[model samples]
Target: MNEIPAPVTSVGKTLLARIEDRSAVIGIVGMGYVGLPLAFAVTGAGFRSIGFDISPERVADLNAGRSYIKTIPANKIAEMRKGDGFRASADFTEIASVDAILICVPTPLTRHREPDMSYVVGTATSLQPHLRPGQLVALESTTYPGTTDEVLRPILEKDGLKSGTDLFIAYSPEREDPGNINFTTSTIPKVVGGDGPDALSLACALYGAITNRVVPVSSTATAEAVKLTENIFRSVNIALVNELKTIYRAMDVNVWEVIDAAKTKPFGYMPFYPGPGLGGHCIPIDPFYLTWKAREFDLRTRFIELAGEINTMAPYQVVERLIEALNRRQGKSLKGMPVLLMGVAYKKNVDDMRESPALKLFELLEARGALVDFHDPFVPQIPETREHPEFAGRTSVSLTTEALAGYAVALICTDHDDVDYEAVVRCVPLVIDTRNVTRDLQGTYDNIELA
Candidate 1:
């Protein structure tokens, strides 16, 4: 709903020229994990870049030389802004002034496990009136197959505008793995798919200017499916390991040690450890989008459903494991037990807690009448969720030994660097290591239980 600034018609046309001359003005929408880094990379690749976000605070942060997103550095953002080519705005109207528009917005799931395309729809619709000839539009949001053709194509082509000829449309999924220092936006090979040849050519030319390689696909649907497959593969694998964790626990064999021994095979094995549950932006949610679309073809994706089942049950399983561990320690039940949770972030290092299992664990514990408090150095504040009202707007406590010892059982939710594992092991009455962070410690008095 943002208004466009003054017409930079020459600047807009110059961006297309820059695409050929490697001086394109790249506009990245939704300046989150994928978008912000991409904007940085485009600027780094000698192209002018603009970062757009719906959050005015995010725009203000960029303008203030600060980065709220964990992965992007503050100086890199500042440098991009200080440079002539880079700018940040909340307005979508100025999108007409850019040659290439990359939609990096959030694609969340509805309550019924359907893909919520509001952000995608809003962005695409906003650009409809401003749709200029020969402008390349690539949807970088992770979505279902027909999203580009069915949703965006119609919305964009509403005003007698032909795709591929008048304006280019494509799909290129963002494969951003946060906290990954080795591979980045420039190094990661991009997947490009277009409505037609011209779209393909323009998308390829645009991305090729920044990225090292561009893998072209048949259609936008294929590109969309590729992203879904990547995340579904992860979801299925993690579910397999989590299910095994439960089975192995009943058999009294340590799943981690079993994985360790099996990992020695080296040839056919890829080790994926079990934990409290799935977190992060992609793996937990993307499969459901695919499954939802598959239903239209009368296809029931069993793996997708099974993965969801197993991953969804992980938090409850962690609570059960905590009960078992606590029972072993005090010869009593989880009722009236003081349980301390360690690390609430979705992953080990990053501060992102979206779809985190730790939040689920916290709610389940409180529901079972167990007193619970979380300690995560990376994530100081835990946001609100639909189900857990008790933990809404609560902040994470310090991971001190006193905090660890006060609880009857310490549940390791995330394994952040700031936690003093040795101290927790020595002082805590009982420990449930979800991420195996405290398994190797020697000071524990046989009180530590890894889930």
Candidate 2:
């Protein structure tokens, strides 16, 4: 709520010099998926990184050279610890030791699908006591525009410490794609927007060291918008294909096959695959953030909302398909019938199930009187989620032949590479292929059906 602080050159210049020489100690808050990779990327660029987390377990794991995230191996943490490159701490007082602090916390949606700024607000409040005049604070969480200037600025400036002048404030949203082999934090180009010229320069310098490129936008709001735009684009496109999948399904056409052939054109034709529903932290959640923010100006995000509606209905449609398949194949009612979800992770080969449709599918099936269990090589036990806490503590059953035969139907929610798709087709009586993992073995088995 404070006025945008005037840019002070002296502190900004000193910080820029420190970043350039790799003398700057970077502080990364929330040592989860995004923060963990970024900390290593910072250290890889020769900067000593101190990671901060609220979880003592996470801090203990990192300090002991262990990794909770699947993609980041334990040996990598060991390598980072070799020369005291990276350290994770629960103490916020350590915030004073770092030159720049990046807030990489989650911006999850509430039950009403509204932006829950609790994590961001809580993180900033915790850092308030340790906030210094010369330190930089950059938010790497995906949020709507004005979050940096409006939401964070007021909270950080609550004590009358000017943001742009004293504490350099910036918003450089994290574009972390978990389990992405092609792009790492260092390879991804970072988009940065600062409160002012001084803040921008320091943020750019800090990110510029770790990343291959830094896209300096005009203001903090613009940077926030960049991340939302990226996720929204994917959300809309995926929704389009999901809609197409339904239309093509009624025509007895394969959406996966259509996409495979269509992508061969290779010009003005980028293929986005259809899924059971929108999953991950971004596609399912970010568009709603924009739509929620849009309501403040009394404007409706019709396209985004429609896309959201379509994606939300996806799990229901998939459940209906499973119901139909069971009735048609076995001539048995869904009531008391056992169903197995092949994968619980949001995406292939990743243990992240933040908003995975598999959980939604589980709930939907169980609500319809079907007994549902899951079998994911990646996710052995369903972790506690705010929306689906009822599913928590349920362990994944083995995909053995006897286990597969016991289920009335198997739904391939996620197409993890390690899964034996052929074995699933061989054992399961009815298979609902949402991800088309059984595309190659279609002729071999008549039991497989596309969701």
Candidate 3:
């Protein structure tokens, strides 16, 4: 229902020229998983990039050429800091200095499972006073369909700088996959949408310089919808596989084997493996944005709601499997037992633990009187998080054979490549493989049991 804005004014044309000429100073707000890689990509494309974060510590680390995220090396940060290519700041007043601004803030959900758009709105409001002509702003945060047009545009236009005229605005959802070595930020296709033709053209040109492919959509809302759709598809598919895993387990059939066989059919099948549960910044959270927004139209997102329900229960199912395996194999109870949890991060090779099902398993195990210890090569210690503060003091235990043998059972929550599965199977008395990490050694080890 949102109307398109006017054509590009002289100010927008000047900004476009600067962007095309590679002289534009690119500013990335919220230098976390998404923004940091983007800043690197922009700087690598021969444009000056400035990273902005509210955390002074993060700003200091980036300014010192130190990498906090594991995927981005300190050497890369040092290389970017070597001239005027990249810098980090906590000051919002410096927004006026950048030619283009990319908002990459988080859009998390409230306790009631509604969209919490405070980060996006707050960043837009903070940049309002610094709004000027000949500057382009693009929001790269994932959200509901109308967010770029409804939530951000009004806040950005409050300073008398009209979008597409005195200023330009666009929505380009970020496709950053942290710890994914197969695809870098530059390799992922950038999807850009805007209020009008000029904004779209400018956004495409700006992102096109960094990435190999730039997909331009008609409206900003459409671009926002694209990100939601992609994540929702993943969430639903993962939920399906997880649900099937339970059914297959009940029937004495291995779901991993079924998936491996089904994936060979190239025509109509796309393989999505089951896991502990959905994690990271996107899959578990982004789908609810659409679920909340759909209620406005008096429509129910049954699939999204169902997928959320199933995925949320996957960790509990894993715990049940562990309990069942322990009771049947060793005639042991969970209470007072020492259990080793392998890999605490959501996925392998990354330190991010946001909404990780492994944390849920840890909490559940402790509640059931199981003494739990975790081992993750990437995460040395559990940091204090907004959601799981109780796990703050826990640190990663060693993965030696001596340490593994001391535990009553070992649960493979995440299949990190560095973990020696053979040693784990040999040392641990009972092994609950939630990730099917020991599939190759299914018959070799008497202790290894797949969940």
Candidate 4:
């Protein structure tokens, strides 16, 4: 491990001037879900943006006007590539051309549930060679408070480049909500902080160019903590509702109805619903990053750990519900029963399948000899997994009475707007609605059940 760098001298004035004049060349690293959209938004906002990724294929795709990320349109990439000063490449030699850089890689969890900083560290190392004076580097990857200080700072300062002084370094966490049609990269409020005043001002000025709102916190650690707090609050709240859902089920109460009624109150309560399990890159993983980092501080985050445990158990509970549903229909268990899963995408609309609960549900069902077939209109080919065969060439069937008649039981995992509830209720024999897509059609389907 290398020593962390100090902030650059007069960084605040220089960075502010450069960003104001649009002379700051923005370099975005790890152009995945978060990076790509940000790159497009920044480039479209009149700043010259350069995308940097280690994957040659990703760079090639971007240069060729092709986008692998679902939310980022290929046409947008094409427009950016053809636009005035937008370029993407795998070569680190072009890193010197960047005046500002954002690190947007995934900080995924290890098998042991520890925070994996390999990608962040690797990205820092790659950019070290081309690091120069008066450049502002912001880490947008979601991790613990000390990540910017403990992990990235050392890697960037290995060549004696001072941070906050020679090079302004900050941590401005990216709040990218994938599959969200309403809020986008430009609309969402951005949180920015850094080691000192110089780093903070630079980050604020830079992000202010793209977003309307910029929240300047005290330090980089506090900014990192902000993202974790947002995610952990969600995790804990969802776990609370999930726990309540189980109790309500035993009491013969529909949790969805309860939530709808509670939502009407509009004053004291905010509704967070239950599902098969916590899915997506943030809810399932972000809290654990905080808990893992807490251990280093000799602090035990019991709330976070307990929330994680409860949320993780939800998938198995859902499988049990499916088994119970099958037992009522056909005197047998999950074993050898053909199950059709509806919607494999993590959320309702967009096509990002990363960390989707549907995959976990499918895997759990298949482990018990239950035949599982998934249909997600957003995702065409159901790629092969560790447990399932290469079920490629599969596509979403129209949610009509005739199309769903073959399946014995249908599990509604993601409620995409295009799916017709009336048609699904009329067709599927038995339905396990995790997302409550069938709640309104309860009177229509006598066989519909809620998990």
When summed lDDT is taken over every stretch of 10 residues in candidate 1, the lowest stretch is 1-10
TM-score, per-candidate, Cα-based: 0.93, 0.97, 0.98, 0.94
What lDDT tens digits, residue by residue, belong to model 4 across residues 183-264? Answer: 8888889998876677877777788889988888888899999999999999999999999999999999888889989999
- Quote the lDDT for 411 in model 3: 92
lDDT of 2 by residue, 321-349 (tens): 88888888889888998888889999998
Root-mean-square deviation per candidate:
5.0, 2.9, 2.2, 3.7
| Model 1: how far residue 60 lies from native, Å | 0.7
Candidate 3 least-lDDT 10 residues: 1-10
Please say which candidate is ahead in lDDT: 3 or 4. Answer: 3
Q: Can you rank all candidates by lDDT, best first?
A: 2, 3, 4, 1
**Any runs in candidate 1 off by more than 4 Å, and if so which?**
1-17, 385-390, 442-444
Please give the lDDT score for candidate 1.
0.83
Q: What are the per-residue Cα lDDT tens digits for candidate 3 across 1-451?
A: 2343334577767777888799899999998989998988999999998899999999999998899998888999987877789999999999999999999999889989999999998899899998788788999999999998899999988868787777778999989888889999999999889877778878888898999998888899999999999999999999999999989888999999899999999799999999988889899999999999999999999999999999999989989989988999889889999999999999998999988888899999999999999999999999887778999979999888778889999999999999898998898899999888898888887888887
Give the best candidate by TM-score: 3
Let me know the TM-score candidate 3 reaches against the reference structure. Answer: 0.98
The sequence of per-residue lDDT tens digits that candidate 1 reaches over residues 110-224 is 8898999999998888879977776788999999998999999999999987885677789999998887778999999999888876677678778888899998888999999
Error of 3 at 388 (Å): 0.7
What C-alpha lDDT do the candidate models reach, one value each? Answer: 0.83, 0.90, 0.90, 0.84
Score residue 449 of candidate 2 by CA lDDT: 91
